[model samples]
Target: MSDLNARVVIIGAGHAGGTLAALLRQYGHTGPITMVGDEPIAPYQRPPLSKAWLKGEADADSLALKPLEFYAGANIDFRPSVKAVKLERSARRVHLSDGSELGYDFLVIATGARAIALPIPGADLQGVLSLRTAADAEALKAQVGPGKKLAVVGGGYIGLEVAASGRALGAEVVVLEREARLLARVACETLSTFFRDVHEQHGVTFELGASVTGFEGANGHITGVSLADGRIVPCDAAVVGVGVIPNDELAVDSGLETARGVVVDLEARTADPHVFAIGDVAHRPMPIYGRMFRMESVPNALEQAKQAACAITGRPAPAGEVPWQWSDQYDLKLQIAGYAFDVDEIVVRGDPKSGKFAVFHLKGDQLQSVEAINAPPEFMMGRQLIGNRKALDKAKLADPTVSMKEVTA
Candidate 1:
């Protein structure tokens, strides 16, 4: 098939799928492009759902990835509120829930993920929710405001972000974390402690090492959460932000290789060559780390979108991006670069008490990762350093007086 004329069918219409469509066109692909999305509306930004959108700082239109008219103007067939039910690999066709079928030379799966529902009693209650989409944000927003109490389950970034937003909205907020410390799964203890203190300063309470037995409800609405220790934390509503499960069922049913997520090569091409998977649904290779991970972040999605688009359009592969992510809580902006693994030494640049510092995780002289709190320069420099894979002076790195340029030299 001619590269430019090959038909592309993208499933999931999310950050990765949406961007692939745009990148395909940008790279001069003139093939028929059709995008299938399960959401009722066009693809939109999800990062703000738990923060700005919940706090009324962002609107639906503002959150949209593109103006609604951009799809038709670009001559892209955008299908909304449609689910892809079955994949017929032999026929190279996709069966949709709407009783329609799409034939394609190439298929991209970007089904993303859904919030994992807390499998506990009262989880199905009206006021118990999880934020993964604009719809979820809207529902949670209505329930949080003055005179309301919001109980946030989990101590990860999402839960803490919601807690910050709830506090901003004048709701009494309490966080329940099964772990003794917050962000135990994703961050170092130093960073976790810093965030916990920040949230506490914002009038949010914490129930650490607290195992939730279930939730308490009255009239089919959550009224409180019951802890394993016979403690009942009263609240009018609750949000479970444990994590998410990737939507890889369609790929699995289609006989695709999947390990937690759809397995793919560095180019995001599945074993079936004709199919590709990106975003949260892709169990892709992290060449820099020499490992495979299913990264759930915009940067990872955008990188894979470019990878797929370039591979399809016969363009040179784009440079690998340094793994990164960010979080905004109140006035604090936390930027994390690279992964924290097998670290030998940690250098703290500046004081955490000042609320503006960077924690550098190093193995010998090589940088592994850096977590910067309200420190943009440190984040950028650290990201570049990690990508460069160069050794640096530890003493100089920890000295705030030394310029980052000099530290690298």
Candidate 2:
């Protein structure tokens, strides 16, 4: 029995699993590390699928998170196109779709997430698509060009980015959101308003407060979108950017505690001692927020995977700083530094009319988070402010009268 090559099996080769594999090597982990994923291609970024990649500015190679040679050089048994069908927790093994079973000393479930399907009539039509993978982006790109009519379902960051990309290609774009306001799920009103103006300035039409109930298609290609209010919109194609659900079926079947996703502690360890979970699949708590939630961001995935790998490989738990998410919409770069939901007040710093502003969401005198649009200094300063539990005077932060560095000084 050679304990020297102790097996470590990691499911899903997304940002979380990929980072865990690389971090294990960095920590001098000399063991058999196997990375498995259902996707045929190597781990690439989902962020660009809605933005630059769709506009033909970024190539597939540019979107690759890590090169193929890097995985080989690090001695990782990378297994793509292999889906983990079942988890045998008691046996310390995972059953694959190909009738093969692999054992692990430490199992990491980074199965990530999948796009939530639109329950509309023509949701499965050929022209109807969901933006989640590289294949989705490539297909959508081919349909976008000059004089095309495109309808984007959902007004979240993903939908907005796609709208911006399609408009850039000289396509007439329309966004359909069920909510009264855009980005209602994640962002505050102040940030959403800023984005609304950005999209409008680019000639992107807003069909806000509208929900898609069905689609008008003849031969599996979407011709128009049918709204819940019986309004029919003529469009060439449709892109669904609703939301995502965590892939937690295997973890839940294995008797691991799961609320929204796999429940993990600060160290990314699940209820089971030998098994751990990370990425968008893990519903971990934030010491700042005092609650547990699944974060569907690349940053969250990498940070949690790094922490989980450290804990499983006998290294100390590297405490995460702050949970952050970023979005690239046209010329503006939206960066959220911390979680700020149900805030008592919203303070705007700088001129949003100029397309450069930051929203400081506050609960009384305490700062909750900063949603910055083209305001890097505020995002950077607000990040430190969130971590240190420091508060800035609302007036000073609002006025472009002072530099952000002065607050730290």
Find the candidate with the highest TM-score and give its number. 1
Model 2 alpha-carbon drift over 4 Å, by segment: 1-5, 405-409
- In model 1, the runs with Cα more than 4 Å from the true position are none
Candidate 1 global TM-score? 0.98
lDDT digits (tens) for residues 1-409 of candidate 2: 1233468899999888988898888887899899999988778877888888888878667877789778899889898889999999999999998888999988899998888987768888877888888888999999988989999999999999999999988999999999999999888877788789888989999988997899899877889999978899888889988898999999988889999799999888887877889999999988886778888898899889878877767777786678888998777898999888558888888888888888888876667799998888899888888887766677777778778755432
Q: For residues 1-409, could you state the per-residue lDDT of candidate 1 as single tens digits?
A: 2389999999988889999998999999998999999998888888999889998989878988889899899989999999999999889999999999999999999999999987788889999999998889999999999999999999999999999999999999999999999999999888999998899898999999999989999988989999999989999999999999999999999999999999998788999989999999999998777888899999999999999998889898899999899999999999999998778888999999999999999987889999999999899999999999898998899999898877774
- lDDT of all predictions: 0.93, 0.86
Top candidate by lDDT: 1
Looking at model 1, which ten-residue stretch has the lowest summed lDDT? 400-409
TM accuracy, model 2: 0.96
User: Would you give me the overall lDDT of model 2?
Assistant: 0.86
Model 1 accuracy (lDDT, Cα): 0.93
